[model samples]
Target: MSAVTDRTEAGAGAAATAGAPVMTRRLRVILLLLLGAQFMLAADFSILNVALPDIGKGLGFSLGNLQWVTTAFSLAAAGFTLLFGRVADLFGRRRLFLIGMALLTAASLVGGVAESPGILLAGRVAQGLATAMVTPAALSLLTTSFPEGPLRDRALGLNGAMLSAGFITGAVLGGVLTDLLSWRWAFFINLPVGVTVLVLAMTVLKESRAERTAKLDVPGAVTVSAGLLALVYGITAAQSDGWGSVGTLLPLLLGIALLVAFYVIELRAAEPLASVRVLKRRTVRWGNLGGLITFTMGSGVTFLMTLYLQKVLGFSPLVTGLSFGLLGVAAFVGGALAPRLIGRFGGPKALVGGLLVQGAASFLLAGIGGGSKSWLILVLAGTAVSGFGHISAVVSYMVTGTSGLPDGEQGLATGLTTLTQLVGLTLGIPVLSSIVTARTTALQATHSAADSVLAGVRLALLVNGGVLLVGALAIALFFARGTARRSATA
Candidate 1:
């Protein structure tokens, strides 16, 4: 913000007050550290999928409860993110970021060394909450550090690229590590990375705190966290427990009840943690909805294909992971090109283009049939195209969602985006899984096992494609339409 006169006056540091926009080597270093934190968190999300089998054996996790090894992390992360994001706004971003890193590092150490399932589960829970803190704090820091312009767009694009790269690497790296080294390395791997991020973040990142402080509403935090936890947990469990089962219905109902209570509490609380007023912004609402839709469609298709590759085609874990390698490359290219796309056509148009591309990719893949020699090409091209669309859509949303927020609310804005992303992922897995189950069950009496599974995969792909197309149309009609009407007015 060195060239931004208003920000220069508002900020105190030499870095902010410089006149020549301070596009220095040092600022680039800061950007890398912030993005590294993003990669760290993203890697953890996929790193354990291949390692879960080994983790189960090593820790004696029963098959019934073994899935929680992964679920626990997501559950805790989604639960506390809103509260911690607002807490960072109220307290200090940098302070909370460093603390989160420290906690995550410690949790990693505990999980890495754990000899018992209980201990590992506990570590995962802490790691999840720590991730909650770091994600929003780090993102808000990046948003606030760079002025909202080409520079910030470039930074956000780069951040999105690293995030995509991390997911690919994590999926592949986990299989490699588990085959060659040990599953424990999956948890231990974050040790050095987390520490380095924490240390570098202290140096390159400047402290930014809200100008005004509000009292933390403890009751609201508790209700909201518990509510979100139950909601996410219920959705996740729906795949295994059956949506109509008592186990699933109970938590889901409780989650809804608590969430409603949280709304009431927030309305009545003195100095509410987060005001519903932020939703008044058109960009926030549309950007978040767009995010939720794209992520759900992307992850849903990927999950279905993974099951198809492993179950029907009998592909090894390593091969399945390597198959996604092209996606990372395509995502990097898209991320590099996104800023230019936004500059030319604007964020809303870029968003519309992205969703269309993703929808087309999903549709193309939906046509792949069993025993076709063309399956390989279909998987590669579909994933590559989706990669381009996914990164572009994500980067555009990041820019559009946080575009106009004041510095004081950056944390909250980022928090909502992160929250939507997790919720989308949490719900996507089960939603797609349930669809596949129902379709596969229906075909079992009429078809072979492999054919049933293949048919189910195709059906899931169609559903994913249909959803993405609907989302694209929504973006075109609502958000992108505003862009066109504004251009006409101008």
Candidate 2:
């Protein structure tokens, strides 16, 4: 019996060796396919922002109602990300990815055909659910497929670049579509791309199952998703209704209570979706906190800048989207350059310094009042500075946060990182929007809509700059100085 067991184990080892090369080739194929899919998903989020006015006009939506077109996708994506990540671990990454792509494609079709705002929002909600599945699965695939070294770093850098590129491309593409075709085509455009990605994914991606099987934490998933959704919705609604409104207050309070309950549930669950023990690590803890704050500021800035350029500066949608190209370029370059910077400066220094620089850049822009200045050149300079700093800080956090984790835990780590950004951006929009809305109202009492919008934009940037300053302080206090040099080989 002992001899037979030994022989079986030997045969298994031999088979693994024989299959290794083929597996490597398959992983490369899978990486490219997932990258393409991720780019499409990321692009879709920002692409429609510039097209929002056209869409509202075409659909006959009120300005306040139109925000849901963006809000629905965000809330859904943010709420279900962790839940879907856990589900992927339980089922299979390849399986969930395929399912997500299909759903996204289907939702795009529905969105294109929708005749009313309600239907469009429904489609967006579906798209959001699909994104929740796709984003984390894509990251998990990358983490598992690439061996942990320079290869992985390059892959991640490219991934970050693609994410930025997608946002830029989406803006340009959405503008062209809205101008030439109808706003409906902004969504319809996803159909062909999604199909192409799905086909490639099926051919190239190999299935991966969890090494240590665990049951789904149903209560945890339910409570957390619900809490996040509630919080996001309440915040967004607060822009229209007063923050103290009972409608908003009830959900906000419930959300906090549920999130606290989720923590307690996690402690008792046999297999917690996200093990608190993992988060206890210094790198993971601080990285998540800093990421949340930075991303919140990023979204707030982007939204305000868009409003300023289009409504105040009177730029065309196409031109407005095109203007962002410079910032996008900076983000791409910054991500590509981050690993080198981290190797030289260490993690903590890069993070804190980057945040400080970004905050300073926003303050610089704020100093330039909303007057009739050389609007293009001034905006470009400010955006480029902030964009470079933002990407630098983000890439640093990504590298440091997931660096020391075991392979199996990489999914949760990535999920946590993404969750922070997702939640931050979703919540931050309303926070910044409220500031803009309130300030716009006050400014309008004394000025025209154009001037009022510009004033609100300036105010939002100032507030966001202050928030980033706080983040910089947090980074310096928590992250060690040598993090920049830690990944020198990468």
Candidate 3:
């Protein structure tokens, strides 16, 4: 009987060992498909930026209407993301993801073949809506599949890296495609990638939803969605119409009022789109604030640098895109290192350290002024360092935000995270652009064109650094207090 038992144990061990590799392979495939989709979505955010000139010229877009191509996408994405995220939780993540991919494919086709501005803008809106569906659904699937701990952290780290890479690569690719091929290829490029991701996702991704389904909160959804739409539209309008203008203030104030109403509705609703309890969690609150700061300051600094590179330094679009390559490489390294750093130092410390590093790097870039090659070196170094810290913070904040949440609520958590990201991205450039525009205009009488531009950019960079430092300090204190409270209970 002892001999028979030993032989059975050995057989079980062998079976388990054989199955391990299969599971590993399966996980890898799933991660690839998900990350591939994420990369495509992120890339779309910046892909058209460099090609905007070509797009406007090709389609005979008026200067007034040209900005709508990008604005339409941002408004739709920001407005619908939270609603779709909750919908994904109630329905199915895989189903939503597949549907999003299909919509993206169709949108890409429409935009690629569009002969008029209206058609292209319509396609952009559809693409934005698709992104709103895909982002949270994909993120929730990842969190649920990976389980909480080192595995999830590592996955999030890679996700952060891919996001940074996608943004930079989109800028580069947009310029190259517009310069070498045609601006239309920028839209066409998504066709094959989207179709492939959609097909593979259907097979690899398992459907996931909340364990206990509830009725959709229609009022909460309507108020929150409309509020976000108005808010984003107002922010974008502020870039051109001035912050004090009726075009900006009307929507901004209305958005704020609607959001406040949504909060009240959620408090009384049977099934809220986003649970107030979850939002009240210390980790979720501070973590999202950190995310918002990092994205806003990071994107804002990049925009300023782009203007400096082009207008001040006289670099072409392609050359300016290439200049950001070092930043992309550093972002990859930061992403690869984030999980290990989080394991060694804990999430809060890692996040604060990243913010500090990024702040210091932005401060360094504030020294950029001359059009000399020496200034180019400063730009490269600053971007590289900032990218590393920025991506590290991104990964850490994501891990921090989603940590300790129930699997059922991962969709809401990720939606909030993605919402902050979109908000930051939408708000960053405009806010900083306003600062630079005002300062440059003020200095134009006293300084040369290059000098005034450089001064404005430098001041903006300093503001970026200052904001990050303040944020890091606040988050550090907040986390420390939370830890002390937990210890006291223990």
What is the Å distance of residue 458 in model 2 from its true position?
2.1
Winner on TM-score (1 vs 2): 1
- Candidate 3: where is the Cα deviation over 4 Å? 1-23
* Winner on lDDT (2 vs 3): 3
What's the ranking of the predictions by lDDT, best on top?
3, 1, 2
The residue pairs that clash in candidate 3, if any, are none
The per-model lDDT (C-alpha) reads 0.86, 0.80, 0.92
For model 3 the local lDDT of residue 192 reads 96
Estimate, for each residue in 384-441, the C-alpha lDDT of model 1 and write its tens digit: 9998998898888777788888999999899888888778777887998988899999
The C-alpha RMSD of each candidate to the native structure, in angstroms, is: 3.6, 5.8, 4.2
In Å, residue 266's CA in model 2 sits off its true spot by 0.7
Highest lDDT: give the candidate number: 3
Error of 1 at 297 (Å): 1.5
Clashing pairs in 1: none
- Runs in model 2 deviating more than 4 A are 1-28, 371-373, 481-490
